[model samples]
Target chain A: MKILILGAGGMIGRKLTAALLRKGDLSGQAIQSMTLADVVKTDAPASAIPLHTVAADLSAPGVAAELIAERPDVVFHLAAIVSGEAEADFEKGYRINLDGTRELFEAVRRVHGADGYRPRVVFTSSVAVFGQPLPPVVPETQVLAPLSSYGTQKAIGELLLADYSRRGFMDGIGIRLPTIVIRPGQPNKAASGFFSGILREPLAGLPATLPVGDDVRHWFASPRRAVEFVLRAAEVDTSGLGVRRTLDMPGLSATVGEAIEALRRAAGDEAVALIRREPDPAVQRIIESWPEAFDPQRARALGFEADASFDEIIRRHLEDEAPATTVRS
Target chain B: MKILILGAGGMIGRKLTAALLRKGDLSGQAIQSMTLADVVKTDAPASAIPLHTVAADLSAPGVAAELIAERPDVVFHLAAIVSGEAEADFEKGYRINLDGTRELFEAVRRVHGADGYRPRVVFTSSVAVFGQPLPPVVPETQVLAPLSSYGTQKAIGELLLADYSRRGFMDGIGIRLPTIVIRPGQPNKAASGFFSGILREPLAGLPATLPVGDDVRHWFASPRRAVEFVLRAAEVDTSGLGVRRTLDMPGLSATVGEAIEALRRAAGDEAVALIRREPDPAVQRIIESWPEAFDPQRARALGFEADASFDEIIRRHLEDEAPATTVRS
Candidate 1:
């Protein structure tokens, strides 16, 4: 199966690409070729498998159609502006997030209209599609009431996905992802980055500022689990997914204190001591508004799994990524 | 006040236009002119008020901008393809309901961006935006799970309106109208038309066939009441609206048996006897999936009112529409 990954330079996109390349196949489906496209250049995976990378802005006119012309059987759409960036630049956010996604769907429709060629599309949505003043545990039946431009754009994308799928132009599944903990590399523009950054930096013996309180709770899944959810969504039997086109992926809900304890258990006192608590009101407001947990029965019933505890998530991150790290007793 | 009414040829549009003309002026605002446009030609009001009637297809490119360029202080957007028609033609539904509304909003936005011009836009949405398997009383917070293409398009339109309003480009409100009862006109394409037709035809001493069972329940508001909701939505204080853009208007919820009983009370048993019931599984499936009632607390708090009971609603129809009928003891 040939596959294309949009926004391939992003953290999750890069991890997903590497996983697919290293596995060399998906559920016995042979991986023939992979195309990675993003606004920034993407690093090619270290594999003998054929890899093609392209750096192009998708919001430009005709870019969507041009990208789909390659006719990949599977497409992973992960492109989006982060929450803070979207709020800061409203026009650019809508241009890239909403219009870009719609244009891509239109391109797929046009291709299928010309010839009955329907491709499987896996779109990575976010929990940000929800807003605050909500129930403690949001159910699938809860209406989408986004408070920011980023969330609004994601909700609109989900609507478009559902409509296109209902029309039978393309086989699509939108996975609403949780915050990926122990996110590797430099901190991005998302306000929620500190949730992962605090642990990642502390494990590296570097001090990290905690912008939220110890009691602040949030839902999380490791990067490995995120990739697994995406893959399972692509391979699952969609016959049961009625008109509600998107599914909320399963994740572990943990408080900041729990996260600290998990880090201590995984990497000992030295790593835990590298953390400093300094709350910023701006970040606090954002954190307080996010959902602490979700009852994702729909996605769970569909065969997606995640770590049961924050410690397991951190351990998995250390095992897959910084393997040289050991507990300093 | 110069007013522009899109879709002035339809049932509610005609009634609203006539009511506005009857007032001779809107509130304390003097009526300088009224422009009416639709996919087909609209009848000029018999009043002495200056009327400009245009018969142009709004879905055509550039038409929306052309219509908005007239600079009307009040714009009533009531245009849409019915549920059945929209389901039959997906492209046309998106073009007219979704894209057409956006074009008008964008045009107004450009006008506002150029100068400090903002107009009160009253968009008529529908209860169809809510899908089936709902609680007996759906709250305003219920997720907008639309079953039909038309409802999805309306939901999208509501999103766009809220975003545009938040940007300070236009002052807008979306009124989610319940199914209009005693809809005075020929039967059209809506699958739920029998909800109104079954009552209206029998009152006129004409034969009417109900495709669903007596237990089928639906939410309803009279045509006059629907117009009133639209007019009130325009003047209501929208500061508290936040991001919950659409307001579910207050309405009466009645089962088909209750509806028949109300008809008997208002027009006697003879009128009710003209009704024949034959179960249509196709329409029954549609009706069974619709929302039985809406907890329109938001709308009521904003001062929108509906008929006290189904009986009162039926009586109003008889008093206003079928006045010439003699009483049969």
Candidate 2:
């Protein structure tokens, strides 16, 4: 199977690439080649299969067409500006997230129209698609009333994916991924960054701030689980999806208190002590509008799994990021 | 008030233009000037107000900027290729419906950024934005799962309108109009044409084909009521809309049987007898996927109204189209 991964330099994208390399096959077919495209040229990972890395701006004319010319069997589209960056710069958000996605779809469509070359296009949507006035457990039927430009762009991408799939231009599946808990990286300034930072920083023996209250909750999954969701989407039977091509992936819903408790279980009370309560009302208000839980019946029925609990999420992060610390735990 | 009508040549656009001209005011402001733009030069209506007609394709570069250069106080954007045509011609549909709408919004945003020139943009969406497995009475929170390309384009437009409004670029209101019954024109090839044909052709003393079973239900409003909804949207207080700027306009829910029965009441058995039952499965399949009814509580609370019954729909058609025959009735 030939695979193409957009945004291949990002954390999840790099993880997904590594997972594919380790498996050596997808959907019962041997891996033959792979193409990794991003805004910057991705580092070439040691691989037996033929690999090509390209720096490309997808929104630029001919970039998508050039990438699609190789005719990969599966296309993993994960490129996007984060919510904070998108909200800060409106034009850049719509340009890259909206227009760039459309251009990729159009490129595939043109190829499909020519020779019936329909590849499975797995798109990464977000939980940001659901906004305020949400139910305790959001159903698959909940209306997409995104409160941010980033969410709107993703919602639009989902719509286009469904339409293109229905028109026989491509086989498309969109997975609305939950926020990745214990994201393997340095701390950033995202409003939801603290969701990961509080756990990630504590595990690394560094202090992290808790901006929201202990009772404040949000949906989450491990970075490893997210890669699994992407792999499942690539090979799953899409016949049942009908015209509604997007699915809300299964995720663990937990409060900040639950997460902190889990952190203590993994790395002891010392690690938990690293969490500092310094409430920032701006971040708290932003997090309040986010979805806390979801009744994602479709994704569950499709056999996509989530981290068993917040403890599992923390355990997996340690095993993946810090093996020496994992031995100590 | 200076007003701009994007689809001035189309049915609802012409009606809206005429209504604005007849009223001589909008939002209690005296009429000053009007611009009518379409693919073909809209025939200049006899008006005491300054009227300018331009043949313009909205999707074309520089066209939207030129249109927004004057910055009309209200913009009634009703231009779109109908569902059937959009379904047949994919590129044309997205080009005109989706890209055109975005270009117009971009034009408005640029102006708003420069001088805070935010206009009240009344965008005409459709119930086609909703599709099958629908609730008996779809509520305001129904997920937008459109079944056709035209519906997809309109849904995308709605998303852009909401996002743009939230950013303070424009004060936009999108109204999802129901299938217009007793449409005053020769029968066209639209799947929903039968909804109007059974009543329109018969009322004009001509035989009309009824392609679906009498029990097949759908949502509807008269063209007159559709015009009223636009007018209301233009002047209504949008503060209550929050970021969800679109409303499903109130419409009467009736079956083909109910419409035929109403025809009998309006123009006597002679008009009802002119209807022919030539069931076309293709048309039936298309109509079956459409929404049957909507609760539309948001539009109701906003004072947007629908025709009381199918009888009233026919009565209005006669009153507006054939005034001389209305006296006979």
How many residue pairs clash in each candidate at the backbone level?
2, 0
Of all native A–B interface contacts, model 2 reproduces a fraction of 0.71
Show model 1 residue runs off by greater than 4 Å: B24-28, B46-49, B55-59, B326-329
Candidate 1 lDDT tens digits, A72-128: 888899999888888788789988998889889989999999998788899999888
Question: What tens digits encode model 1's per-residue C-alpha lDDT throughout B1-329?
Answer: 88999999887788888878877666568788999999987779777889999886677888877888888888899998878788888888888888788789878987887887798899999887777559999988887768877888888888777777877888889999988887776766567888777788887888888999998888999877988898787678888888877899999988999999888877788989888888889989988888888898888999999888877777667766775463333
lDDT of each: 0.84, 0.92
What are the C-alpha RMSDs, in order, of all predicted structures?
Answer: 2.3, 1.1
Per-prediction interface RMSD in Å: 1.3, 0.9
lDDT of 2 by residue, A11-103 (tens): 989999999999999999999999999999989899998899999889999999999999999999999988989999999999999999999
Q: Give the TM-score of candidate 2.
A: 0.99
User: How do the predictions measure up, each by TM-score?
Assistant: 0.94, 0.99
Best by TM-score: 2
lDDT of 2 at A124: 98
